[model samples]
Target chain A: MLGDNDGILSGAHFLDGDHACAEGAIAAGCNFVAGYPITPSTEVVERLAWRFPGTGGTFIQMEDEIASSIAIQGAVWAGAKAMTVSSGPGISLMLEHIGLAAMTEVPCVFVNVQRGGPSTGLPTLPAQADMMQARWGSHGDYEVIALVPNSPQECFDLIIHAFNLSEQYRVPVLFMMDEVIGHMTEKVVVPPRDQIKITPRRYTKLPPGEYEPYRAGDDLVPDFAKAGDGHRFHITGLTHNEKGYPVMNAECQEQLVCRLVDKIRTNVEQISFFHEDGLEDADVVVITYGISSRVTMRAIREARKKGVKVGHLRLVVVWPFPEEYIRRLAKQIEAFVVPEINLGQVVLEVERCAAGTCDVISIQHAGGAVHKPRTIYDAIVEAVR
Target chain B: MSMTPAVENPVEQLLRSERMPHIWCPGCGIGTTVNCFARAVEECVSDLDNLIIVSGIGCTGRVAGYLELDSFHTTHGRAIPFATGLKLANPKLKVVVYSGDGDLIAIGGNHFIHAARRNADITVICVNNFNYAMTGGQIGPTTPLDAVGTTSPYGVCERPFNLPFLAESCGAVYVARWTAYHVRQMTRAMCEALNKRGFSFVEVITPCPTLYERRNRLGSGLDRMQWFKENSVIKNGVDTRECDIALRQKIVCGKFVDVDRPSLLEMVEAKMASVLHRRRWERMSREQQKPIAMRPMKG
Candidate 1:
């Protein structure tokens, strides 16, 4: 099925979307993957389990989501680019560790192939309800990078990008996918090892005595050292100084908290990635992400053919909000329509980024159903009128 | 800030400067528990560089931060899973986990049973101090039924967990328990668990000085240690059924289960070997080593 297009197949055959993500991780130099079998996302771990051994990587089906999440963190700390994939209920169990990774600034990838949930609402269905939770789930204030993909090909590309951004920023980059994209079957051309960019976390070659684990120079990201690299340094969830020792004082807490939040917020422009179309003469812009964006794109094109001035903005990087693109569009567009499968997750973000320039509205549907193109097309037509 | 005292043995040095001054309070049993871990590592693991220590959030969770080997101070109730990952990633590395009562039994209960069922090659050192120490002595899963704590002002109503019994029932290869007062025995137990090749669990009945002491009116560290010494009985070939009854009434301390089982690493290697053998028929010799060709991208 995988006929060559623009690159060497890298011995990667055309598989389902889940297998593409697994192969993408391997191409990104991931040496370890841990997961528990939750539907929709289970195939991700299964494929990794079958392929990793041949690739000289390790795969483990952990007992639950909590263990699977932590195991990946441990492997990453041991100097491997590691990952874990899970669904809604499992992702709920992993939130605490996700916050820990944010606090400790561990470079790891969390692939959340989302299913409908207030609590396991639809185990095998698709919903983007976790868009807000992925950004601000854990307690306390911190910045995390999350990327959404609209297709099986983007799933492969974005997974590699997620690992790269995680290593480059020293933050846990989340790969957000709904069940639709995660389970979809499509042909993806995976480039060879040389062409695919691999970014490992920065390692300190200095002696063990001189290495400071959490030394935030100017980047606010800590210097990481792997276990067998012979560097000995402490890492804790408690507020600590640059050397990674625990500091119980409030001043240390404030300094650490401020820097952690500011690092990603300040560098959001470089961190945010998305695409915009037909903005110059568009009356209404449809803002969407993940698999929902695919439907919205179709709706926008359909409305445009009917003499409506419709445009589309698909977010590849969901967190960091794509504020600059939205701000630039705010001056030209009359109405911003956000169509999501959740109640009101990303619309709030669009509204805030709009900054009172236009009428920001949401076309929302919940409980495991797709956002049909007609509903979104009607919203675009009304907004254009 | 002063320099730590020196000791001759590396294990002793590990206990002194490497593991202490611990974050535990003056009379807390966590320090002694960590001391035993240091001794165990020195005795069992020949290469300290190959040792990986993983811990969860709590007073007892701080054990990883003090260890001489590479350690991970993870989130609450997730230490076992983290250690599971560390071991599977590199089967050459020896992984051990240290977690508190609340961390392992309550929040991490799912991981605990699952790790046991999978039979991963990891040693778990669970310090049961009877209450949540770092969280200001809340009633924990290991807290005695009538025990007083910050949350259990009128005494804890729920039944406490029998940790060793749970480990044994869930198929841990080695299951043992020792109080902090029995330092030598605890260290020996830890060393034995570390040496065993499958999922091992060692529960140490540690003392909580700050909140646990104030609420229970245990008076001091000496009084609690004395109580543990008098009440708990050390036995061999202990059954999980009998242990649960003892847990209801008294403290049960013993080497409950020690049997061999196939570890997760062993199973993975076997599977890989089979798959590799199937592909061996089409293998090429070392003489042929040509670089493959690639296609160009449009972008």
Candidate 2:
């Protein structure tokens, strides 16, 4: 019953991890949510179903991950900020369509609250196994924005950021959260409607006579024409010119591919959102994200207290990764400690970004549990000191 | 009294003429499927504003290239998911997914079953050309067993998928099969399916002229049409057992199932009601959480 007129301090209450995510997405101005219930992420849909309508939005429980992903894509095309949350199996099912969204340059959000498995490994359990898949899950070399969230508040804030990035780049943004953060109940403060920043769809508010769907300019993002806008525009996953027509020529294919890739790559600075702590004169930097980052942060704090020179760099955006920052830190640091729920995913990114400057170490785990601060603390002490 | 000036059709009148019709080959079954779709569009609720046509990569997928509506031609076998997105985005739109046999059953098989299971409100018009006509007649999932094609040099070992049966099994509310020769029946089936409430599938067993016919010695496109006309039998009433027998003998080509299921959007909204209610009840007495001094943001 919260209204736009109600000038109330709408803050966070103690809720399960998934519900917090739902609330976060709602507050982030997500107007459409399409998903199927899978473990670790089901509560997200459950929370969204109720919250979406009151905001004059829609929530759809699609037949499967494929349908859910498609529905979200459609909702976004209609000029609404839309999202879908899923897990491992669901993500696998959506890989093909995710590629389509990428190729079509459709702005949408896909939340993969990771669960264990190549196929339905552990529905109720937590695992970060989809980290690699999130970046390279879909076939082909395409640029995708993936954000990793560690806590309930982040679940809310980054969803808004995710929506903004999707709109800005006109590409699907993957919000990769693990089952732990998805299920962990935490108190989060949602800002007032006026206080919260929102990115509306980049629409062509022109007369029907002057509309070109894939009209290119300095910005690779197409001018979106929502369904009710009366503008006739074509959208397809084919290799097309700026006019959105299927072009069979190699030159056209090259141009289209470059635009799709360059749109994200060139805008890396705008996409980068991270937190750095105690990097000055520190020998070891704890590089982590998602649920693992939370533990790594605590471990950094504990190690610092013990006079071990260890810092933490928590990445909010996992794709179009903060390579420059990591590269800069690599020169100063002796070792980069990357702790993740999976065996080793982001470590490779850190290693590549860091190159041979620092010893990139992976503190990995993949049983339905969070990496303890002690495990991270041991890595820091062993690597740096 | 003046008639309610028809909602001033805000969108451009999706003129069929906008689609210059010469692209398709002469005597092509794709033209028929496209015609059925065009006619079905008229039969569908006349909210052209919300009507979206999604097609996949195929000769039939080219349907989107010519259609004068809100159209999307997605990747191979990915039209179902793409249309699912469009349908979920705005439930107001009457979404129709047009794809070929290879596009629908082979690459897009997962999306197909799931869309049916979800009972997504989108209508799927699968033109079963049996062969991958666009890519030089590769053996598709719906390619008949022992049938010859470009990839299957000698013969195909895999049995063709019973598309209607598969749709019904996957939980589609309305499922039907018709050959290209069954022009009236196919168009009518498409119209009814388009007008239906939940996930509806109309599988048109269309002929492939260039590769499929040439390789299989099915003569010309006209000859293939005659084969369909002579082979297919219309069954108005029948049990599952009898239908299966007829299908096995390649005789029956009719609407197999028509039943309502909880559409994806409806089910989602209902579940959303409960989640929202529970959230409201809990949030009534409490406050939302403020951001911490330092933590990673979750999206």
Q: Pick the candidate with the highest DockQ.
A: 1
Candidates in order have lDDT scores of 0.80, 0.77
lDDT at position A282, candidate 2: 90
Estimate the overall C-alpha local distance difference test score of candidate 2: 0.77
Error of 1 at B61 (Å): 1.7
Q: What tens digits encode model 1's per-residue C-alpha lDDT throughout B1-299?
A: 99888756645545326345666788889878877778666666666666778888888888877766677787878888878876765666777888888999999898899889888888999988888888888998878778888888999888878888888888899998888998978888888888777799999987776888777777678888988888887777778666652222466778888898878766665666666644531241121121111122112
Residue range B50-164, candidate 2, lDDT tens digits: 6678888879888877777778887777788767766665666677888888888888898889888878778889888778887788888877777887788988876667676
User: Per-candidate DockQ versus the true complex?
Assistant: 0.40, 0.33
lDDT score, candidate 2, position B209: 80
Superposed by TM-score, candidate 2 places the C-alpha of residue A257 at a distance from the truth, in angstroms, of: 1.7
Each prediction's TM-score against the native? 0.89, 0.83
**Could you give candidate 2's per-residue lDDT for residues A176-199 as a string of tens digits?**
988888878778887877877877
lDDT string for model 1 (A257-313, tens) is 898888898888889898888877888888888888888877888887898988788
Alpha-carbon runs more than 4 Å astray in model 1 = A1-15, B1-12, B15-21, B153-159, B209-219, B227-232, B238-241, B244-254, B278-299
> For model 2, what is the alpha-carbon lDDT of residue A180?
84
